[model samples]
Target: MTRHILIGLIALLPVQAAAGTIGKSEQVQACVLRQIDAAAPVADCVNEAQTECLDLVMKAPMASVACFRDARDTWNGYIGDRMAHISATAPTELAGVAGIEVKYDLLQNLMQCDRMIDLTLLREDPSEATEAQKARCEATATALAYVKLLLQSRNLN
Candidate 1:
């Protein structure tokens, strides 16, 4: 679980870095405020997205799988709720591109979380685990690629 948290946190490092340099759009901020006001578990998602949890997974691979499984459940819930909100409230036009981008990013993260769970459950031996990890990594890579395409479409319009 801790390892999963670490994995997520590690993934978020770039986001955290970019967050400070770029100002978020009003639409995105409004979405966040709504989530917070609704007391969604999204805040816990951010808290776990820090780098401090990575060592636990590195030290104990098998134990880490269990933790990853638990973490997946929490992440699944957060992503589901956020996706629902975004689907309902997200803007579809160019001026709302930032909000749409935020939704795309969240969708990518949701795919990553799904892959983490699949990798953990499919682990049998080191070789098999490696294969599973490769597959899961590919899934996330595909999601990111798609997100890039979506953003490009948004910008092209």
Candidate 2:
């Protein structure tokens, strides 16, 4: 009985570390950033946003949920501004260029990141989010990475 209890306690330790206290904020942030950075390339935007949102929750487990809620809204505005510029210019600048399709594809991918952010980050609550939602957020981050890479290739970033 004593050994069984010890084993049970051991099993709970990782969970406690992951979702327990604000003192664990740095650990939580590192874990979340790893998750976001490791996401598969070109994954869905919502998945990326969800992963980030949930990670923020894990980072500040005891902080008010409203902060995360507000974060998404604020982040969406930033992403929206960047996306708006691409949307306004892509149709014109992307025209008749060599490899235009690739450029357009990358542009669309970035725009999808914005939409996914809206659906996952802005609209959802991290505390109650499902695995699927988190997956969408991870996807968004992945797509963002790819877009960044593309932009850098063109000296845009």
lDDT of 1 at 136: 33
Candidate 1: Cα lDDT at 11: 52
Give per-residue CA lDDT, model 2, range 1-157, as digits (tens). Answer: 3334323323322222122222132332344446557774332333343454456555554332443333333333333333334334444443223133333444465466567656765556654433333333333433344334333333222
TM-score of model 2 relative to the true fold? 0.27
Which regions of candidate 2 are displaced past 4 Å?
Answer: 1-64, 93-157
Give a tens-digit lDDT track for model 1, residues 80-127: 333334334444443244334544565576677677656766755445
Alpha-carbon lDDT, every model: 0.39, 0.38
TM-score of each: 0.32, 0.27
The alpha-carbon lDDT assigned to residue 91 of candidate 2 equals: 46
